[model samples]
Target: MMLYYIYDGTFEGLLTAIYDAYYERENPELIVAMDNFTDNFLIQRRYIDTDEKKATKVHNGIINKISEDALTNIMYAYLSEHENAGKYILEYLRFGFKVGRLVDSYLSDDRVHNIHKLARKVSRERHLLLGIIRFRLLSNNIYYAPIDTQYNTACLLGDHFAARMADQIFVIHDVKRNYGVFYDKSKWFISDIDTKGNLDLHEKELFYQELWKKYFESTTIKDRLNPKLQSHFMPKRYWKYLVEMK
Candidate 1:
């Protein structure tokens, strides 16, 4: 019987779950953010929460067993949040287990190639959001931005904005994920914020939104419009946060 391990959707939590699974004699399948069994065939499943110590241990172990690049690739794949991330990780780990120390050379393998490709895509999206995200100044001197992302990228983008906008109070909402980053001009924190309640635009903010929408519509060339190309560059999922579209 294959065992199942569930984690709390953090990289550290996943590592701790991996540490738990490693002690077992039988290899098991690991999953995150799932509570139900697919087949109802009496599968043994265990849930693990984030543990910094256990995660550090597992991370250190992986570094000792494989190269740093392997660990980075695995972390990138984990961040992708793609449907097949767990299976992709399993394939990567299997390759690592067989090759022991030379698995990095398997970058050409289809499984490894896909993981790297997903990582690059997610990275690019996060980078674009960092430079392109616009914040509206609220009445209380707080800047706010709302976003909907296909990946869990709020934490990553938070670091970038916090450093650049260090002198101002700001919050960035990942509307799709129901979480956001709040920076009070000194420190930053992440929390679950309901966009419906917090994002009621004030008159000034509304005016800016209107002006941005007009600018966006005005900038488009009728003869040069390519819906497919535009969609590929700026996916529909993120349009909710784009000031130009709003």
Candidate 2:
């Protein structure tokens, strides 16, 4: 029987699923997000909601079994939402279980190398967004930034902003994911904000957005314009949240 483990699309959820599968002694043919489910009678699948306590235990176990860097790499790969991420994670976990502390050397193996490569790509994008994401100050003294990312990375991007913008109140919305991070000087929290509803923007914010749009247009050289090249650099999907693109 081909068992399928379906989970909520969160790092903790994935880890919980991994723990459950291992404890159950079942090798899942596939592990997929709940949202991606397509009912098929031939498959024996089970959906699991994330259990924080179990996830924490599993996370601690992995850290104890492998180096902290290995744990980071696995989490990064999980956040990427890339195809084959589940399979790669399973492979990595298997290697870690076998070698206990020497799993890092498995980086020399082709299977582990591919997983690390994908994890690095996702990590780089999350890091870049930390510096590149622009925020507009509203009249209420709250800063707002809307972002559309290829990877489900709003949570990943929040840590950097929370640390850097410690003195100000700000929110960074991942329009693609319909979730955002809101941070005040004292505390930071993550929540789902509806993007379809009225977006609160002040006149000053609108002016800044207009100026950014104008600047983007002005900087572009029509003579050298290559839509394909531009798309390659900044994917069109991200244009929706970009102030300059608007």
Candidate 3:
């Protein structure tokens, strides 16, 4: 008999699914987001809701039994949004319960390897965005930047930028996800946004944009052009929001 577990697509929902898997004593052959579920007469389907208590239980279990790095990797892997991410995370936890923290060291295991690999990709993208994100000063004096990443990475960038620009207000909008982190000098929080709304820019914003473009033009050596190397560091997809690229 094939059992499928469908979840609400949130991390907590995924955790709740893991909790039910253990207490219910049923191993799911397929774990997927609820929206992705389809009708199948051969498979028994279960929809798991996001339960904070159950999610916390699983979270505490991971932190205590496994390592903090393991929990972090699980989060990163979930954020990867891979098609089988839910199933992979459930399998990883199932193995982690047996060997405890040593589960991470089992790189030979396919499930463990996949979790770590997904985490590495997410981490690399987060690091790359730190240097690539460009901010534009708005008329309200708030520094606003728009990002459209393929992965869910905007949430990971808040702490890094907040610490660097502690005294300034800024907004990092993930256009692809329709949510952003808004920091007002003292605190920051994530919220949904409408990217199509009017953005009142500072009077000198255009001047600064031209200046940046001119600087980039003057600094580039036409004879020493390295399109391959430049593209390697800064992917072309991110060029849309860059002032210099404009």
**Residue range 154-222, candidate 1, lDDT tens digits:** 778777888898999999988777888999888899998865555444559878778888888998999
Highest TM-score, which number? Answer: 3
Clashes of 2: 0
**Candidate number with greatest lDDT:** 3
Which RMSD values do the candidates have, in order? 3.1, 2.8, 1.8
What is the number of residue pairs that collide in model 3?
0
Off by over 4 Å in 3: 36-43
What Cα-based lDDT does every candidate model obtain?
0.75, 0.80, 0.90
Clashing pairs in 3: none
Per-residue lDDT over 1-246 for candidate 2, one digit per residue giving the tens place of the 0 to 100 score = 667888897788888888887788778877888876676888898898799998998889888877687788888887778767876787788778778887767778866786788788888788768756778787688888888787777788767788888999999988778888999888788999976656567678877778778888999998997999977877676666667766
Write down the TM-score of every candidate.
0.81, 0.84, 0.93
Show model 1 residue runs off by greater than 4 Å: 35-39, 48-51, 64-68, 97-102, 194-203
